[model samples]
Target chain A: MSAPLHDLTLAEASAAIARRRLSPVEYLDALRARFEALEPRLNTTILPLWEAARAEAQKAARRIARSGPRSPLDGLPVGLKDIIDLAGHPTTCHSRHLLGNVKAADAAVVARLRAAGAVFPAKLATHEFAIGGPAFDLPFPPARNPWNTAHHPGGSSSGSGSAVAAGILPAALGTDTGGSVRHPASHCGIVGMKATYGLVSRRGVFPLAFTLDHVGPLTRDVASNALLLGAMAGHDPQDPGSVVRRAENYRRHLRKGLKGLSIGFVRHFHETDQPATEEVAAALEAAARLMAREGAKVKPVTLPSLTDFAAVNRVILTSEAASIHGRWLREAPEGYSALTRKRLLPGLFVRAEDYVQAQRRRRELVAAVEAAFAGVDLLLTASSMDPACRIDDAEAVEATYSRQARTPFNVTGHPALTLMCGLSKAEGLPLSLQLVGRYFDEATIYRAAAAYERAAPWAALRPAL
Target chain B: MNEDEAAARAPGLGEAWRARAEEVAEAAAQARMMAQGFRAPADETAEPMPAFAVPAPARAVR
Candidate 1:
């Protein structure tokens, strides 16, 4: 209890709640106070569900007192990216287009979390429809990085990353199609996981791309990320993309050291393919060394070019996103922010032949990644090629946005988790490394991440917001 | 919508829209070139990844 209430990780808060040492109401009050102080600076929340969250907290406290907790997430607060549907709340998506888009049903993931007795405190900010970059023209101002308010928090899971990193929330959900979840996690110095495609149901979450969209969790640390993912993962028959796998105790393997594991370091990804900055490269190297020292057999592994994966990802994403927003583009082109319109507009020109080729190429890329996993238990690479650039600097944002190694996994449908590996000495921003696991092997990813997290100094380093 | 139809409707939207369309067109052209240019190891007979299946017949209510 030495730490501030808001500083408790999701796992810590859950433990405290179970022991009856921390009342859910008191924890919620502490977080609400933090939000009040920091929300003005961060712009992380689009809709604050303060009153409802208070009622939920009291209900959770009473339920725990009467019998026992429903789940580890029973009394914990989890923020939703605005694109996620919560019954009777508008899934605004930070665009003028859907200002009145209130739905009557919860998203599949939301329903699952509600069943787990998780409390929803706010609808977090995201880029328009999870495709656009940060923009000043959107209905809601983009979320700022808590590490340095002047720097960009990666998006389209901008607020999810910002809030969790800022310690305003212990955990939040962010949808990743082409690195939305991991991008923010990388920039905000937190843990974000994009489990294998179909591992988490995407129903009721607004789509960026039908084949590629994935819903993921963002938390301050690796174990909390795994815990959140445990509560969120399961099959929903209604969601065509949801895999029919049994739910997992994601944290079960956290204590398992890296002794018997073989890690494939995709050096070509951050070096030859899309060159990362010096600090990021050094951090990745240090992480690989640390893992090796921790008993993981780390070795170099190669896959297809980052360009090829990026092209395939972009082609499919733009094509599907364009199709979904086609009517809007035709009818109300003016409603979209200029950046969003520009980003979505490219899909219109993507020929059917091009899209088909992309998908065909995607199959090959997936196979390529799978083939690489033949010798290794996991793949290690850079999440973002550089630390976050300033949010207001459009040129820097544009230059650094695509300089990432994440889209490859989105294309390949592998489970990838990004966590802080080190900080950039020059800028004091967090530098991140990625751990990718085989399909449906998130527990192993968490194991390796937890191992590395324990050995590295990054987990204890917090943004001085 | 097809490229021609988009082009036909784009200009009338406004200058900003037109400019955005132009930027998109340029970028799309580059992406198309890159996608088309990259030769996959797979042969011409390779099928795209998405598989389509016929839906099951609905049961009649008793």
Candidate 2:
């Protein structure tokens, strides 16, 4: 039997397209059929660009046949989180207030994807304004986890996670602020990376928290994540947060393995600081052993406590969000979902002194991460406290919101990534392991994660949709 | 400040929005306290707060 088109990773499909074994049009057609069958149940896409995407695919097929692939991303179908503008498409952001908002120009990332000959087939769902969700009260429904439809897929890049995991798209762009991209990636059983802050331009992506927000990629595997990030990364003069740095081939060192490298196992972050389930803890311990077996010197290392990071992250996020939305809150108070209202309101009460103190603490946290990096090349920890819980359980969702070990990277402006490590013993969902790297060190992060993907038993498993 | 007082102090966030805004403020207050707890005193002459700066570009030979 032939391998299914939808099952091909971005790397797989791109190679096939380049070799003339697979046509871009054929690949997109297969994915479109899958999306049609599974989308209603998954609610992963808020806007489907069926005709436009088909035309683009056909165009790409012709180009590939005439010449060759444009880049590693050529002819691959990718989803854009609704918060990303796509030049004339609605950037709804899953909010009622922005239902009429349409893009005047493509977001920097979207334009880059187009230049790479990738097809944008849909606008994936996001938390309202990228901060207020899994909210049912929004204009669109929250995406369900494909592993089990009743479970949450994480958010606010909720749809990007589900779509990639469900094979509707091999890769998608997601924004991470306080773990939006990594959270969804963990729950959806995919690879997501929030590379060093300011590495990817945030000019066209909607803001959640200016300093905290990061544009990232969600892919079914580590190699594809690397390819997608490579395509979208470049400094933009328009984005003040963007940094001018030499571009990197993120996949250049994927096979370097873990030999002669120091991997820091942040056990206390999961074991004591936030306390994960037995299954999650076991999975992390096994991951450490697997890395050690792969010839990496895995050892315990400590940074600031998880509480310190979360406190600093929340204060900064809320204060910035409050400042951004204060006008809207006063003008259209009822337009927002109740949860978002609650989440953003706290920002209003943050005293100026508190915001300044958080900024100062943020500096210290950054210094701590830098210090930790002096001893270890990479840091490993639990992605979440446990497997995904029921999407409908409001209290459970609220409880788990701040229970992850991801916010510390955002606070400190380092690269962080999450990938499946094992299956949850209690809930049968994917348990994830997080890897953190020093600023602008995504190649090392990819190298280590690719090694884990090869050694870990979880990579071959897929959600039975 | 308490929620009620916070809402009242703001010009537009009045009675109907008071309770919700207050709840948000309370959450913010808790986070504030938490941030405060993580604070460690620095030296009397510690350098000024960190700020973002533009990197100086390389210059051409005269």
Candidate 3:
């Protein structure tokens, strides 16, 4: 017997829809049934657009019957993090302050996805304003890891990770500012990419930090992630950060093997910098060995300490986030969750000289990374220091925030992809590897990640939920 | 600035908000220290990093 519709990857479902073997409506129904059964426990979505999505799926089905698929994303049911605006729909950002925040127009990325004929079934949950999260006091409960529902799924793209992993949807939109996309992808065991800073437009998405925020995709597989990124990419004049680079066929290099590729293993980032768990350390070593065995040249490349990157990132992130939330934080300080308030309020204390200094440090760090990339095509590092822990553990959550090596790229504006590498022996939760490429070079990053995914056994495993 | 002095000197900040800012004081200080390392020898002549500027739209034919 064939696998269930919900079990199929986004690419598989898109092909099935195009072949007429599975109608868009049928696929939506399968996902709806799965969502109904699992959503309560996972809390992945804040607003489930059931009837509207069914209507759209029916429209897509008719279009497929009359013509062919509009794009690779056609008829694929996907979720958007609540931070993205959908015209005539509310984007609550999982905060009480923005509960009435409805958009008059779709976000640039959402508009592109709509043009591609992708079906939007829900707005996934997120950390309140995509910064502070896993808190009990929020407009919606934080998303739980499907691997072990009690454990954290990482954030601020919490729901995007959980929804894709739970198979409620094959793919979803996520925004990464300081490893939000990769963190959940790491903890949830999926593929997430923070495309080059300007590759995807941020217009209409709620901003946490304009200079640091990135819109990306979370998918169960690298191929699907590539497909989603291709659809979402392009320059938007409205988004100041959007670049004018020509659109790339992200899937063009997916099948290219790792032979002749050079990989830089950033051991010190995890070992001496933040110090990953033995399981994570072993996973990193195993991943490097697999790449070397696959004909890729793997070498250790050293950069500045993780503390330097984290310090620079936090300074810029906190300062900018404070400026954005200044009004609400000052007028209605009670509107934000305690954690969000705590995390964001610190920016208020940052001196102007300090913000400038952080920017200067950021430039130096970017130069250091570029220098490292000169000798290697990609840099590999741990997505998180350890596996997912119980969501209720406050101390663990605080430590995990500073434990990730994913934020360095956010500071450098380089493209990064995180994919499952192994499962922790103790918790059986996913451990992830992050691949960093030069700015606007996601094609190469995806090439390396796809090669790694092909050789790794982790992608074959899925949550029982 | 020390935590107490920074809080007391803060503009229009409430006691609770001041306490919250104090929580990340060490992090702010670390970032500041890193920034100092980026200073060029002739720092006064260096240009400050510019904020992101919106791109101008293409002009339509008259």
C-alpha DockQ of every model: 0.18, 0.21, 0.16
Which prediction has more favorable DockQ, 2 or 3?
Answer: 2
Docking class of 2: incorrect
Model 2 CA deviation exceeding 4 Å by range: B1-6, B15-37, B40-62
RMSD of each: 5.1, 3.6, 4.5
lDDT of 1 by residue, A273-354 (tens): 8899988899899999999999999998999888889888888888889889987876688898888877787787677888
DockQ of 3: 0.16
Interface RMSD of each: 9.7, 6.7, 8.2
Q: How far is candidate 3 from the true structure (C-alpha RMSD, Å)?
A: 4.5
lDDT of 3 by residue, A55-131 (tens): 98888888889998888777778899999999888999999998998899999999999999988999999999999
**What stretches of model 3 exceed 4 Å from their correct place?**
B1-9, B14-45, B53-62
Error (Å) of candidate 2 at residue A36 is 0.8
lDDT of 2 at A221: 92
Model 3 clashing residue pairs (backbone): none
Fraction of native Cα contacts kept in each candidate?
0.26, 0.17, 0.15
Chain B TM-scores per candidate, in order, are: 0.36, 0.38, 0.35
Looking at model 3, give its docking quality level.
incorrect
lDDT value, residue A5 of candidate 1: 95
